[model samples]
Target: MWRIDFFLDNGYENVSMNDIVKHAGGSLATLYKHFGNKEQLFIYILEQKSEEVFGEWGRKSVCYEGRIEEFLTETGRMFLDLVTTPDAILFHRLLISIGYINDSRLNKTQIQNLMSVPVIIIANYLENEKVNGHIEVEDTYLVAEQFLNAVKGPFLFQTILGIQIDISEETRLKALKQVVTIFCRGLHVIQ
Candidate 1:
């Protein structure tokens, strides 16, 4: 919690274990004991934040069992909302900026895990739909990734690059609907 706040306020590269201990009023040994190291703590913070943003969707719940379209629409909207936030953009930028630094606390595996949460959740839903014969996807992972990118790509890039400050809810919904339509049509074909 404190670590997340500290990281957000001070940036990932700027914050250190000592700073976290000082601000959090905890011992370094305790922090290390609980989180293993800075990378682990950072990953934990990411997991917590993802859960907060995505709610039960982040955990692969089967809430959309009989309604694939509803699931895609809701998940697309939520994913767009999460990634377009200023805080999310800043966090992503921070991660990308420091990702290649020598001996960086964040590593490829940790970053992949953080990125994989939504994909995994979406893939689980897709797998369920496939089982029900509602859709046919040879690779749920690829489909999930494509669906996410279609939903998040335009707005996320614009927000991250300062090209667009904010997108209207109407625009967001329309785009999401368009993507869901395209994806559903493609997946509903006889196979």
Candidate 2:
């Protein structure tokens, strides 16, 4: 946790194991024993952050109960809330910059696993909706990805570009409803 805080305060490249040892109260040997190197440590931190953000959402047992729209609106809000935070924005920027420098550091499998957390959660919900006969989705995974991108793309783009867009609560709620309605319609949801 200290290492993560330090890295966030100072960019990843700027921090060294010695620096972490100085502040984190661990010996160099112990640090190396836990994490092989800086890249590994950074990846570990990212995995931890991913789990913190998506773990509960991914693990919760839920059924739509014929309230798919309501579920989508609430999930969309949660997704937006998670992505729009200052820390999340900064972390995403850091990851992108790092990816450009050394793409291999962000291993494909690791990235897929991290990115799949939310998708898997939403896919499970969609599958439940399908089984309950509330919607017709030929591909739950693709639909989940599309729905997330639709709800999160515009705001995320603005955020990534450092643009400040003030959206009122009412406007945000209306937009979420519109997205959910359109998505459900696409799924051929009845009522």
lDDT for predicted candidate 1 compared with the true structure: 0.81
Model 2 TM-score relative to the real fold: 0.87
Worst 10 residues of 1 by lDDT: 52-61
RMSD per model, one decimal: 2.3, 2.2
Please give me the total number of clashing residue pairs in predicted model 1: 0
Tens-digit per-residue lDDT, 104-171, candidate 2: 45465776678678888888888888988888989999999999998877677788779988655666
User: Clashes per prediction?
Assistant: 0, 0
lDDT per model vs. reference: 0.81, 0.78
39-158 in candidate 1: lDDT tens per residue? 788888877777776667745457667687888998998888878777878877777677757877577787787788888889888887888887888999899999999998768877
Give the clashing residue pairs of candidate 2, or none.
Answer: none
Q: For model 2, give the 10-residue run with minimal summed lDDT.
A: 99-108
What would you estimate as the lDDT of candidate 2?
A: 0.78
lDDT for residue 16 in candidate 1, whole number 0-100: 82
